[model samples]
Target: RPRPITPPCDLRLQSQEVQVNLGSGDGARRSMMGDSSTLLSYYHEDAKTMYEVFQRGLHITGERDGPFLGSRLPNQPYKWLSYREVSLQLAEHLGSGLLSQGCQPSPDQFIGVFAQNRPEWIISELACYTYSMVVVPLYDTLGPDAIRYIINTAEISTVICDKAQKAAVLLENVQRGDTPGLKMIILMDAFDTQLLEEAQKCSVHIRALRDPPGPDDLSIVCFTSGTTGNPKGVMLTHGNVVADFAGFLKVTDKVIFPNQDDVLISFLPLAHMFERLIEAVVICHGGRIGFFQGDIRLLPDDMKALRPTIFPVVPRLLNRMYDKVRA
Candidate 1:
């Protein structure tokens, strides 16, 4: 027999009279059946830019000795990146290196990100933001034709890819003269001598931008999954992202309060809005993020190993977990 559920003594039905003022001048009031205790609110000043939010997060929590981001290592423990190390890498290595390489994309120009959820992916994203380049995320599961469509539609000149297979596809397109405007392809992983030599021989001049992008400028162009037809692009500004972060904080401050001690296990694709938003929120709160191994079948083991406090997931994943539990 199944165990019966118990009700708490505090559960009760009560009616309370609440008065709501229409405005300051009108002096009108309306009666509502609710108590003040039922209401919750949170307030915060809006940030001027997304970069400003990041800067504030760094200012508040960068001094802590705890790791800010981590990834699982093969047959070993997780490798971690401290807040200070992340900042240094963004400033000294990824950001500066891109600039030195002359990867100066124009305002509103799309820079493609073709990779899985990794530290390099985050670095590339932040580096693009630092120079005001618009990002176009390309999912790893997308085929060559879909990839070609996005590249052409967004007029992506430069692309940052993680694996050799993706790079080969892009190289094939470039060689076949399919992507006329394509200039450079940056591989996050180490590349062979032949690939590097071939890339150098291309006409694309890999250079950095001269000026920083403004808050109102378009930051990213997210594409829909295109279950119906062709994928469509949705442009969002830096201010839009900043406002969203601020709004989310205002709404969920009481329910989901993240702290330095909290650990967030990242499994969703960074290209998804939910994951990206949560990542920004976690960083703002100085929480640690640990990435799962890139296989869904390993999620249970990863969860066990990471022991995360917060798990943000989609309905499909949640349903699967529930089914597994029931089974």
Candidate 2:
């Protein structure tokens, strides 16, 4: 007979009892977690789609812009991006531009976004959401081959990139016929004329976004890091992403929900769900978000500049900070 192994310590403390009954109180009522343990939604309308989440903010706030997105240069303070322009006007223009460029406004229509945490990235994402299109994000660490694989797999037609270099990468892919589905490459920043001619020769349209309304089936086709093997794309619905923010909302609604006064610093990768959920929560509340200056070593400068109200922290970061303060 085998002897029972003792635990290092009773890490699993006694489970506490709850006050609510199944389906009687708020949140989702699941039997395993007991009555209303799960959050059904915290959205005022219980926003079922990304379109509604974007619209819900406007409806609640009565169309207030009030400095939404922010960014900065090296050692410079964060500059403002108006909420009315980004959340409303730019989205509409981009969505209309996509439609004009022959891209359909459907859930199956995928748009690629290859960039860091910037206003343009979120603006492009909002454009997709507003037009009922799916967003396929390709981050920097995703190598050339993986990027090609995603573009083909998702049948991505329009790809919005941050800078000229990323647009060049897509153009090269087009030149070699690696991305046949790719037709339009939208750069978020200025590019020289040489690149435009190169794009023209490759039979691809290139434009800078100075530039979306609707229900989306899939929210994001977020790819894995391919640590084990090739990267696998995970399909998430609008409800799936919104539910995360809604869960956050349910937790804070009674105490403090984020308003226009709230500010978030988006240094974390939106490729991961953590940052995406944080952005979603803030966006639903018309809160401000500031992007770091693309360097972790200089994040303290950004911290001083923005004085962000929200931070995406893990135990590791907290531990490091604790150690630094202790030292």
Candidate 3:
């Protein structure tokens, strides 16, 4: 069950000086203007890598006890995977499973993730980071032409999709030779022997990467929505994402306190930076994240079941919810 929300402390900006130590033993200090009006002003020394942030959370949460990711079935109660369970699955199952099958991604290679907000998506992202592969997130709402353009632009040979339907679209492109470089389509839901056989005939291997990615290496290539024209790819490194997490903590620590017991409901697409950054923050703070069922109609029921402590929402969703309440 989620804890009741507590009133947030008043947040205001003032002026002072404070020392920031970067976890180094040396008394090296960097002075920065502090907020004199609010006692909640705090900053986390920047982490060198996204992996370090994850490691910090695992250490803090002790891995085995609490829920890290939660989801639901058609009529069953929410299912949970603990931090330890998730980590072991990533390291032993998914990572090695891909590698053994010859799915090795080159350093900083672009791999596509076409899926909804599920635990598999999170595992896949982490697996890519572990192998130093750059992830290209594909929005589920994107049309076929747009998807083809991004895949070609990124030169993605292998993609991980949540369902056979999504994979079928990519598979069709592969067969037509439109996406010549595309070699494999990994479906998260169920194994399709026919697809595997077809991929094999096309000489594409279904696999994972051999080497782990470093902090400074490229982590994601996020494509902007092609509202006016074709989407543009934004390259982000592990350091860049870690910096964002640090910045978020520095600013919101006072008003938003997160801990092991915190529960966050995720409905926004993970392809968007806002949701992705919030996911990283929740993981860093040792909180649980629950994904809403893909249908918007089920959001209300899902929310009631999950009982999320923190709701990170966009203005559109907020406006709709407000209208519903007023009615």
The most accurate candidate by lDDT is 2
CA error at residue 298 for candidate 2, angstroms: 1.4
Candidate 2 residue lDDT tens string, 17-117: 44565675654322232124455633556467776776665555564557778989986777887767776689878888888889888887899999888
lDDT of candidate 1 over 1-327, digit per residue (tens): 636433322234332334556566455332232233433121234345555555555666855756777888655577888776776665336656665666664456678999988877776777777677778999857667778888999998888888766776787787788887788777777667666556666564432221456668887788886777778888878777766665556545655577788888889998887788777777766778888888888888888888888777988999999999999
Stretches of candidate 2 off by over 4 Å are 1-42, 211-216, 252-256, 322-327
lDDT per residue for candidate 3 within 117-157, as digits (tens), equals 99888888877666666789997677788899999999887
lDDT of model 1 at residue 220? Answer: 79
Task: List lDDT for all candidates, in order.
Answer: 0.70, 0.79, 0.74
- Give the TM-score comparing model 2 with the true structure, all chains together: 0.83
What RMSD does each model have against the real structure? 7.9, 8.5, 7.5
Candidate 1 wrong stretches, greater than 4 Å: 1-46, 197-212
Q: For model 2, state the Cα shift of residue 201 in Å.
A: 2.7
Clashing pairs in 1: 102-206, 102-207, 102-208, 103-207, 103-208, 104-207, 104-208, 104-209
Name the Cα RMSD for model 2: 8.5
List the pairs of residues colliding in candidate 3.
Answer: 98-208, 103-207, 103-208, 132-213
TM-score of each: 0.79, 0.83, 0.82
